[model samples]
Target: MGHDTVETPNLSFGRGRTPGRSTPYAQYARLDELHSLQHPRSKEPAELSFIVTTQVMELLFDLIRHEWTIARQALREDDLPTALAALRRGTHAQDVLVESWDLLGTMTPQEFNSFRSLFGEASGFQSAAFLHLEFLLGNKNAALLTMYDGMPDTQDGLVEALRSPGLYDEALALLARRGLELSPAHSEQRYRPSEEAAQAWRRVYTEPEFAALQPLGEALLDVAERVTRWRQRHLSAVKRTMGGKPGSGGSSGLTWLRKSAEQDVFPELWTIRNEL
Candidate 1:
């Protein structure tokens, strides 16, 4: 038996440093700047854990957003290879995010309580970038846009994503182009399943053409599964640490996060899987 993986070479900048051996990785590596970060409000040792976990999550979220953007762009240009690379990035980032929750899990109730109030009305729900990423993934909830209202860049970005058809929309459209008879009813709204899309995907899986696109579909599914896992793991962490207490940012904490955990990233992509 044999296996294959797609490799997308990146433009990693390093000056005369060996790939496998470096005395101080950071010294040899490139960093834009870190001067503005790591400002822990409380002088508590545990506060560092809370702040670092949040920052790590934010970084992972940024990577997810980047990959989804690449995936969307790939669909637009009919560049499935590029799209697959982007989706793979999201899949890898999802693993990192789940681990971040594990880091937060180390903070016991007493540890969290010391610095929880310092967070003020700032909960993960209020993360505008995260919200925009959700909308880009085809989850449109108008109410979630409220937090971005006063912030122009975030508001504009999310509003644009909401109006635009998502990555899956482009994929279904591609299937239609590839001769799937997608009924208008199937795609009208609500991210419902498409018989045509499913059939086309089935053909792709059963008799794959455009060899790279096979991995494209798989990569998308991988990303979806990993993201869902991250959510589920985070919810477990929250429940373990805080129980049903309200979130520091004013939401209904664990209960509210539980509902968010159910939100799907690419709904139709998963629906097509059963038919395949």
Candidate 2:
């Protein structure tokens, strides 16, 4: 019992052979390239957090956009379960996106000032990914496309998104297919909250026949509410860091964000809740 036995090392592959360049996980993730992208402009210590957080938020924005696009396509195909799943995934992405501000929120006005000038004309308001997300959520402002005039591909895609059917459009179409009297024109036009649409949602909630749509409506509402909350958090962050200053991208900053936040994401969903 006192005698010690030799211990053998556990190696899945050949001894001393580490997972090399052929590793599928590294190849698929391209983590090396991803990690290489963060080059902050200033020597300020806090700039690193700002840079990485913005990059993370941009990546999350892409994920949210992808999921919402999947949800819109699913809705178009009359697949409620698949659409709900995608919307739920998108909400998770939004949750992370909203929390991302906490990292940058730690930066004070003086800290941000160190590298703020390095930003020049760049600002979160100019984020094309976020603009695309807003378009998909049924808030299309064609004027914003002007901001990307130098980027033809991005501008064209945004124009197409502006004309395309949004998530709310597909939701209304689903309701129409189920015998609700919603106009197809709502799919292309800037959406306005209508009394008739509210009544339809009321039916979806109160009537047993339309019960299947209840969860879809609630999921859509959940997304809209989360988006609004994210906007509120964004406004708060900007106010805390910059206070009344104009955005580096030539926008009105907090005033503009405040007005923008007041604009509802899915208007009919909230309007319907009043009737319910």
Candidate 3:
């Protein structure tokens, strides 16, 4: 007693369209556009590996930044579980980022030289996304903004990130709110370890009543450890591929990386351990 109803598919573009144009996956991911972006300046096949690896790392950097932003906001709201979940996700992304160096770890000096000239003054150090990550991690260095002088939008974003409270700052504020005494962190300045922060974290590790806060401390330490590993891997990769050369983008290369590798992410997180 009912009439059959059927939905008609849209056929204005025709059914024989290429997969790149018609597939839902391709349209959502913009596969065709992504594939079109690679234009290798050098004919050397190894260059493709370099380009792809760099691009993948850049994407991962943004992804990690996204996770951290979520985690930071959650921490501000005292949502420990959400913050921890986001940090765990960010650490997983960090693991992928660390492993990504394997794609370039074995490149011989000869292979690198083939395309090194093409990079002329361009360097991974100039990545705005990575800089955003650094700022979120409390490594606020305003001088680096000069690098983006030609990119007003990027520089503006960096300025805002630089001025905003970093992940650790939010965590510290949460600790203070929870009755732990700590000095207020100035988001625009580079982070320094405070004895007050050290004492607060020490309580988190040692006091039975503060056991709930231990996981937050551990999560932060996990993030810090992964960041250190990323830096170490980067240093090792550069040393293996091009020993002691001045870096692209006017960086000191090995010297700069060595210093960076020595610097701790979330300094108080590690320093507190000695007291614990």
Candidate 4:
């Protein structure tokens, strides 16, 4: 008996694709291009792990930034439910970002040293995606923009992010719209804790009238706490792998990270707890 062959249907799974020729998963995900991105500069087997993990982190940073941007935009429109949903998603991304340190947390000093030289001035400090996340979180530092002077497109993007109203800024604006008074925050400056902002948040926690905003305040705090955790985990991972040595990107390594980890992400949100 002869068996008849069945022809596969030509289905379009992604844009501009010959459907029957390739696996839809690979084509849609562009897995070939993503897998091709890891070009380790050294023969050390552990180098690939480091490079892959770093790339994974950069992708997560971009994801979290995207969520925060959505939240900021939603808050600008006074859509509390939408803003809270986006912030909750951002915190979940931040949670994964913190846990990603597990991939590199066990790197021995010798293993890192084996490929460290190959990195040569390249460092996570230079990650534009992570910097954008920082700016969106209101950690603006104009001096850091100088680092990307050679990369004009990246610098331009960072300049735009730096000048845009941050996630916290929109939250405050929403509060002001609801009859709470708050001083305008400087878009291009690093976030500073203000008594006025703290008092506003305190009202959210204590006053029955502003009780509707309590969830929004809590969601913002959740995001801030996760960001602090991510920074602390980064500091811990670097300390264990490289000790007090200077960073590959020309910063004071552990010292700089320690200072950064110590700083709260949303200062007023944290400070308000003392009074509440």
lDDT of 1 by residue, 1-276 (tens): 258777554335334445553335444442423323678887778787777788878887888888888788788777777787777777788788887887777668877777778878878878877876776666667767787778888787877877777777776666566655664222223465556666666777766464445676677678777768877887888888888888777888777777768866556556666766
Candidate 3 overall Cα lDDT vs. reference?
Answer: 0.90
Worst 10 residues of 3 by lDDT: 12-21
- On the 0 to 100 scale, the lDDT of residue 100 in model 1 is 80
Would you list the rank order by TM-score, best first? Answer: 4, 3, 2, 1
- Model 4 stretches astray by more than 4 angstroms: 1-21
Q: What is the lDDT for 245 in model 1?
A: 88
After TM-score superposition, the amount by which residue 178's alpha carbon in candidate 2 deviates from its true location, in angstroms, is 0.4
For every model shown, the clashing-pair count is 0, 0, 0, 0
Candidate 3's C-alpha runs over 4 A off are 1-20
Error of 2 at 188 (Å): 5.6
In model 1, how large is the Cα lDDT of residue 4? 79
Candidate 1's C-alpha runs over 4 A off are 1-36, 183-190, 194-196, 207-213, 268-276
Minimal lDDT window, size 10, model 4: 10-19
| 51-134: candidate 2 lDDT, tens digit per residue | 999999999999999999999999999999999999999999999999999998767999999999998888988999999998
Q: Name the candidate, 2 or 4, with the larger lDDT value.
A: 4
